[model samples]
Target: MPELPEVETTRRGIEPHVTGAKVREVIVKRHDLRQPISPTLSTIEGRKILSVARRSKYLLFGIDDGSSVMIHLGMSGSLRVIAPGEAWKKHDHVGITLSNGKQLRFHDPRRFGLALHFTLPPEEHPLLKGLGPEPLEETFGVKYLRSACSTRKAAIKLVIMDAKVVVGVGNIYASESLFRAGILPQTAANTLTLPRLKRLTSAIKEVLADSIEQGGTTLRDFLKSDGEPGYFRQKLFVYERKGEPCLKCGTPIRHAVMGQRSTYWCPKCQR
Candidate 1:
């Protein structure tokens, strides 16, 4: 699934083209996705897009009337801007034509993406309510992370991946962040010292910012709205380097399953 950086990249890529543009048409090629397409989506037609925003991994398209369209790019989904007359490829599930003659197209090979409508105060929506603060925000500082981890005995890797703890730190970025902070993935969350938590928090922010700058890591089906694969995978230090020499200490990188997701780390370098 696309993580925060990937989702944010898509938002930035498509925002300028879609914002302020009036919707000329709304087409649902299929009504079944991870959730059934909401019939209220038809209300988007003829509305002017006010702005594009994001919460967690969902894209929020704000319209003139205060209602918004929320979209989640599932495991194999992507959004692209194409000319109205362009031939539709397989799995192009939703299309919103803008008055500017450009169309925002959603394609999800696995049909796990979503196109739904919501009222103005989208934050209160069940899907977004209680979501942890954005990782890049000041609210997600070391003190916040430490408090969230204070009572948890779960593995630090799993603890940080919890959406209620901090939004958008997915499996790939979690491994990379832990490796950078020199904390083992299996460490108990509450056992971490304040200094270590500080490092971990900084690592999370740094890794996420770097990935977003590189257009997000493309392990499989992820792509930027412009159809480019992310280049950050080339800069990965530990996430998938199992059996390879550690970049820092030259020890073989190790791999294991934590929180049911594959984790990679340098045994010598990452405690």
Candidate 2:
């Protein structure tokens, strides 16, 4: 699935073309995705897009009438902007035609993406209401992470990846951040010291910011709105480097299954 950086990249790539443009039409090629395409989405026609933003892995399109459109690019999904007459490819599930003669198209071969309209304050929507603070925000600091970890007996990696603890730390990022902090993935969350927690928090922020700067890590189906694959995967430290020499210590990188997700770490470097 696309993580925060991938979603943010898509938001940035499409914002220049979509923001402030009037919607000429809203097209839904399929009503079934991870969730049903909301019928309210039809109201997007004739509305002006005010802004494009991201929350966690979801894209938010603020409209002129105070409502918003929320989209989630589930596994194997992507969004692109094409000319008005561009031929539709397979799995192009949704399209928003702009008055400027461009179309914002959504494609998800797995049919796990979502398109929904929010008439209420978007922040109050069911999907957004209880999400944790954005990991890149100043509010998600060492102190906050320490507090969140103190109450969880789960593995440190799983705790950090919990959306309720801090949003957007997916499996790939959790492994990379833990490796960067020299913390083993299976360490008990509540057992981490304050100093170690500080290191982990900083690593999380640094890794996430760097990934966003590099346009996100593309292990599989993620793509920027312009249809470019992210280059950050080339810079990975431990995730998916199983059996390869650790970049820091030359010890073979190890792999394990945690919470049903593949985890990679340096057995020697990451205690």
Candidate 3:
């Protein structure tokens, strides 16, 4: 899935093309994606996009008329911007044609992403209502994370990845963050000491910031809006490096499944 950093990179890449541009057209090449395209999406035609905002993996394009078009790039989704009448490739689900003759195309091979439109307040959207604080935001500090982890019995990795706890900590990031903090993926959330929690919180911020800077880890389905692969994958401390030597301790990294997601860690380095 395209996590926080990838989503943010997409926001940065596409904002210049679509932001503040009038939507002369809204074309739904298909009737549905992960979910059916709500009829309300048609209302965006001719409206001007004022700004673009991201929440978790969802992107919201603010319109001049107090409305927003929300988008989610599920596993294999990508967006490309090109001139009008550009050639459409396979799985090109949506095309948002702008008055400036530019079109923003949404491509999703699995059709697991969504684009929804609404005139209701953003707070009223079902997808946005209950999401927790963004991990990159100032509100998601160590003290905040500690309290959120207080009552959880699930593994520390699972707890942090919970969207209600902090949005956008995906599997790859959870493993990387725990590895950075020297916390085992299987450690129960409530069992973490204050020191570990503190370190873990800081590591989350650092890894996420670094990933965003590097344009996110180059997971198979993720790429920058401009189609550049991220460089951060080479800097990964443990994620997807099972059997590889840990950089700090020379111990081999291990992989395990937690909540159906593959988790990587260094047994000796991460205690």
**Top candidate by lDDT:** 1
Q: Going through the candidates in order, what is the number of backbone clashes in each?
A: 0, 0, 0
TM-scores, each model vs. reference? 0.98, 0.98, 0.97
Q: Write the per-residue lDDT of candidate 3 for residues 1-271, one digit (tens) a residue.
A: 7888988988999999988789887888896787888788878888899998998889999989898888899898988788778788889888999987899889899999998888888877888888889998899988898899889998999899889999999998999899899889999998888889989989999999999999888888776887777778889888888898999999988988889999999999888
The worst-scoring run of ten residues by lDDT in candidate 2 lies at 218-227
Model 3, position 251, has a per-residue lDDT of 92
Compose the digit string of candidate 2's lDDT tens values, residues 214-245.
Answer: 99898588888889899889999998888999
Residue pairs with backbone overlap in model 1: none
Candidates ranked, most accurate by TM-score first:
1, 2, 3
> What number of backbone clashes does candidate 3 have, counting pairs of residues 3 or more apart or in separate chains?
0
Candidate 3: RMSD over Cα atoms? 1.1
TM-score of 1: 0.98
